[model samples]
Target: MTTATPQTATIGHLLRDTDLSRPAYEQLLADATLLKHQRASGTIVPRLLGLNIAVIFEKPSTRTRSAFEVALHDEGAGCTYMDSASSHLGSSESFEDTAKVLSRFYDGIAYRGFGQNSVNELANHASIPVWNALTNEWHPTQALADMLTMMETTTKPLQDVIVCFLGDGHDNVANSLMTSAAILGMDVRIAAPAPLQPDPAVVAAAQDIAAQSGARVTVTTDVDEAIARADFLYTDVWVSMGESEESWDHRVPLLTPYRVDAAMMSRTGNPKTQFLHCLPSIHDSTTALGKKIFNRYGLNGAEVSNEVFHSTASRVYDQAENRMHTIKAVMLSSLASMTQGDR
Candidate 1:
């Protein structure tokens, strides 16, 4: 892990995982690890002390929002949050206008929303650095946190680790994970039904990256093949935000077979194999969605079983906490010119 310096800052916007070069990606991971220790030791030196950032969420969030807000505050910066209902981003004002306006007031913008183009359009217009919090196409920040978590939890170097992601292979998290893994030279696998598999373009792009980085990328319908010998097994909700509840009517039957349970964990054939999820998971009949899933499907969990999610092998929480650290590193790296103290 290399230390991140101001000179390492290159990209002005992180709209996708490929936005980061391998060195830049590793640098952020190293900085994130350093920041985590700094926070724990109460030795954090505020870098972006006078910076103000605007965080806008067209989609609902808990972890992503909290991570950005806390990361800003922890670094002695100010942030203004605008939720879906509160923001005039897409209604009264155009994205270009909104971006131009925010650039005048804020040092950067963080957007979590429906379209990849929306965030890209915003970044195209804004002079300040922009981050894609999450979009329909890619969740770059989540991938960064995921990678950092893998690095921390495993003894093997990331390039040597095998990661298998199951369920909704075409989704944002899957796309980002595949791309990130390719960039980092990791063995990445995705398992899903034929119709639910990743987009061909995304797969091709990942393969191109893999060719350059020495990564092995595999996409298949066989869950057993994907999970075997994997160091980490990851999944996300079958249905994503902004999608209608009617999605469950079709998705349930298609994704049930891919559900991660004790049996799937055992199939990994490695006692040291760990579980990962970018939750809001239906591990129990607690939340409204979980209850609906349990009642209709007669299954306790939709994507991951409760036993595995609560098991010692689950590193989801560690992955969740890394969101803040990695996001902080992103902001620090991108907006290094604005920081006042030592990075």
Candidate 2:
């Protein structure tokens, strides 16, 4: 495993998948793995004691929120969480003002919200490191967790792994996944309808990175071409957060063919092939969105079938749990230079 040298001074923030060099990414994963072990064995050490962080979310989250709060607490750091309803982040107070105010009270700020520009503006004004938990353009933290999960689940080297992401190629998850995979020299394929495919600029950028890293990047409408011989079959929600319910009407018809069912998994022709999803997956008609999808589309699930989601091949839970460990590593790495005296 490639270990990362502590480069706290250089790692000011995690705003995008490409923010860190490949070695930096590997180090975070290495640290995350060690942290996981330490936590499981009850040998945990607090690294960010006396530090404080502010997490602001314009959008709701489950894994990202829980992960950050728990990771900070485990490291003996204080965390204050505020959603749009609670804080006048963008409504009353400007991002610049909020950033300045939070910088005085916290060692770092993590924002999960709608726009990339919003986070960028906050980072511009804030003296402390600013992490982008998620934005309209990228979900860097989720991508990091996904990378860690892939590293843990596979026997192959990071560069040798083949990941095929199905459905909603234009979304933030796909963008981050493609960028991260390219950084690690992984073979990444995106299968989606023409309209839903990743932005041409993102694809071109990933291709450019892939060329330098010896990675094979493929964007195709052909599911067979993307999934064939893939080690991991990945997917996300058909409809993302903050999307109108009307999105289902159009997305259902377009994404239905790309859903990760047993049939799609078998297409990989590798029994060891695994399934990955950044939940809250609609694998069953349990949630309101799931019920709505079922009632309207006459389908039990969207993006992924229940059978595949529950199968042993499903590593979603491991992926979900990894969010915490990876997040801990990121927080520690970025704040590595900080000391109790500084705090």
Q: Pick the candidate with the highest lDDT.
A: 1
Candidate 1 global CA lDDT score: 0.92
Candidate 1 per-residue lDDT over residues 1-343, each given as its tens digit: 2233335555679999989999889888888989898898888888778899999999889999999999999888999999868878899999999999999999999999998999999999999999999999999999999999999999999999999999999999999999999999999999999999999999999999999999999999999899999999999999998889999999989999899999999999988999999878889888888899889889887899999999999999998999999999999888886663522
- Cα lDDT listed for each candidate: 0.92, 0.90
Query: How high a TM-score does candidate 1 get?
Result: 0.97
Q: In candidate 2, which residue pairs get closer than 3 Å at backbone N, Cα or C atoms, i.e. clash? A: none
Clash statistics: count for each candidate: 0, 0
lDDT of 2: 0.90
Query: What are the root-mean-square deviations of the candidates from the true structure over C-alphas?
Result: 2.0, 2.0
